[model samples]
Target: MTRPLLDVRDLRVTFHIRREGDLPWTQPRELHAVGGVDFSLAPGETLGVVGESGCGKSTLARALIGLVPAEGQAEWIDGKDLIGLSPRQMMKYRNDIQMVFQDPLASLNPRMTVGQIIAEPLTTHHPGLKRAEVKERVKAMMEKVGLLPNQINRYPHEFSGGQCQRIGIARALIVEPKLIICDEPVSALDVSIQAQVINLLIRLQRELGLALIFIAHDLSVVKHISDRVMVLYLGRVMEIASSDDLYAAPQHPYTQALLSAVPVPDPAHDMAASVVPLAGDLPSPLAPPSGCVFRTRCPRATERCAAEVPVLSGAGHQTACHFPGPLTEAEIAFARRTEAA
Candidate 1:
């Protein structure tokens, strides 16, 4: 197999949770924000990460870009481990990987002009670039992201949500990063604007050959842009498969439930179609369930699910379930019947 541009292996992130009135000041409580996760992204490919809220998708993205402290291996480009990099080395590595945060209004600096915001990365990374050159580069980037060059002088507040996100994308792309970790980029925008932003991402990716890890809760939104999809639950990956295979025939029970919830467009056909809501709320990450993180909500879960954790195994498609497979015809018929009544 060809070497991928980005390789993440057993990536885990933990945070210290302190109560208002805890016992000893020296003692600290640990919360596992991200459980072990493994995935890869080829050069110019997009891997969509989908899950419910607080499922650690954003935390994983932050860890990949080194914005947050993480344990486990995140090897980028030529097998360089991000976890071991020093502050100075990490500073230099920042130019190669960037992130587009969820909230555009909060991600941008209110005080900085659009030009300065975009040029800041270049000026810091490539100090040799003169003032005129920096300005020219920023203008070019603004244009690349569909923003007018004149708007370079404006602040983020002057633009709409979509326009502000464009500025954010310009800032990330201006550095010419090899990989971009997009954390729910369009969830904040209206449904109409979401399509526009998604389309813009697809166009830019094809043109620039940018490797992407798009994190989103909406499975259908990511389906349009991603090559492969990874379904996560309670900080653990439930399934990983090609977009064609996963959506057409989901394996894991959790994945099945998620896909079942997406409303089909046509009402006349598949008139019995309806969403299947998962049984219960996602368990707390601080103290995740004993074995399978999704067992509490998975319909097919058994005693084995509560005892031994299932390891991901498959050739092209992997699912972390002992009895993972596509739903049978009878099962589909039953689900439709249940939804109707």
Candidate 2:
């Protein structure tokens, strides 16, 4: 068994935000963004985090890299805790971890040339590198990510969306980071272009032995790339399992609902398919629903769900539910009665 490159436990993130009508002296309320999330990543492994918006997907990713202030253990491979590091302290790990943001154009600097954008990390992290060394390394990386070396002088706006993303990938890889947190990196590209970027990440991970935390709402894309998938709902994990297990037989009701929603290609199948549509809105994180955060929307939720929080408990296929397995329609109806009660 391989040791994890990064191990996270009971991770939580909160933001102090002021409401619109609040007075100046009124206390800022805590928006509970991430709540007691836990997972680990072996070196070179990809962990895909999927959930609807405001499920704390982005918050969890940023917390791992120390971009956002977080609490709880984010134990690195070397046993260093990544939880409470000051900005100065976290800088040491910046070279070892990097991020590729969701927006390709917005993430890159329009003012800086592509070469400078790629070289900036190397120059900042490894200050003693000679100008020629940085330039040569940038050129090598540019070629590696399928961008022509000559295009190094071009600004970000000069390139297409896909090309811009390639530039972003080059920038993240130039530092030779061990783990890269990709926050919906290809979401903005065309469907065909998304495939290209995904394949590029796959190839690079294999080549460099890099670990990845790929965050996106696209379950199909996540299934294609991830070794393990974690299902989050309003800051808490509903389930975690191998991509094969998750897609083949989802254990949690929330997970099953999500899987049911993925579009099937065949028109005949699409016509006959049944979606397990969840009934309620995503509960507010500012004041999350008590007990199981997902209970309100889960089709199989019951009295136990409201009274007691279900911890993730399983060997390989984990789920936070009292009845964690395949669900029947009758059971779903029973849950609805509980909701009405």
TM-score of each: 0.94, 0.95
Clashes of each: 0, 0
Candidate 2, residue 123: CA error in Å?
A: 0.6
lDDT of each: 0.86, 0.90
Q: What is the per-residue lDDT of model 2 for residues 1-341, given as tens digits with 9 covering 90 to 100?
A: 77899999999998999989999999899988999998988999999999999999999988888878988999899898988988788888899999999999999988999999999999999999999999999999999999999988999999999999999999999999999999999889999999999999999999999999999999999999999999999999999999999999999988987887899897778522356666768988988877898888777667988989999999889999888888798766655565456
Candidate maximizing lDDT: 2
Task: Show pairs that collide, candidate 1.
Answer: none
Off by over 4 Å in 1: 25-27, 269-273, 328-341
- Top-TM-score candidate index: 2
